[model samples]
Target: MPVLDLLDLPAACPPGTPWLGLDLGENTIGVAASDTSRMIASPLELIRKTKFTQDAERLIKLMNGRNVSALVIGLPMNMDGTEGPRAQSCRAFARNLDRIQPVNVAFWDERLSTSAVERFLIEDLDLSRKRRAGVVDRTAAAWILQGALDRVRDQATWV
Candidate 1:
């Protein structure tokens, strides 16, 4: 399937296929995946920043292993709902991925996702700063995926 908007994701993916979420940063790429039913998302792994080909290869390997059918990448929009450099970078990454992989790709507005997760880890989870840093990316990826899943569920109710 081709790339799609978050709101345009298919109502149902193939059986046993799951969606992957990505938090693409300059230094690392956080990964998350949904269950087959798409009810929950879990933090998977963090890929260190590398050349585009290397990053794409690593992502494809993970997708192959997890049977991922679609990708939901966090789009970092500005506070005023405008696209910025970060958002452009994400879109570029998606374009590159689409060229090399057959999986569907989509972007989800990810304003404050990382900050929110960091706050939760510090205040509620009481995790140390170092520990939080290690897992924040993956956690943010989960947060992004969960938001997308919730939207999907809500849309299902209307059908």
Candidate 2:
């Protein structure tokens, strides 16, 4: 399947199928999934980054088991809204994943998603630094997914 824009997802994906969101980091791939109703996004788990084939297999397995209809991956854009090496890598990952799994994939602008989640963890949740490190990625994944869900659901701010 092609890599789609956020707005294109609703038409491409089957209704009531859950969407998977990923924060693909160098060391780990944080996972999130929406409920079948697509109302809320919740952090699922993290997959340790191994070989590309292994990672793809694991992700495909997750999609299959979870009935994920589409994917919303966090695109690591620079603060100035420029595409850097990390953004290139994210596109490459999406292309390779499409070849392997053939799922509808969308990229959501994820500038500062990690930092924002970290800040929330520190200031509001008051989590320890170490604990923050462990959950930050997945939390960011939820943040990204929730943003997409909000847009799809036509929430106030997304408009």
In candidate 1, which residue ranges exceed 4 Å CA deviation?
A: none
lDDT of 1 at 23: 98
Give the alpha carbon lDDT tens digit for every residue of 16-48 in model 2: 899999999999999999999988999988888
On residues 1-159, what C-alpha lDDT tens digit does candidate 1 reach at each position?
Answer: 466867677643575689999999889999999998888999999999889999999999999998888999999999999999999999889888878887788789999999999999999999998899899999999999999989988987998
Which runs of model 2 end up more than 4 angstroms from their true locations? 155-159
lDDT of all predictions, in order shown? 0.90, 0.91
Can you give the TM-score per candidate against the true fold? Answer: 0.95, 0.94
| Candidate 2 colliding pairs | none
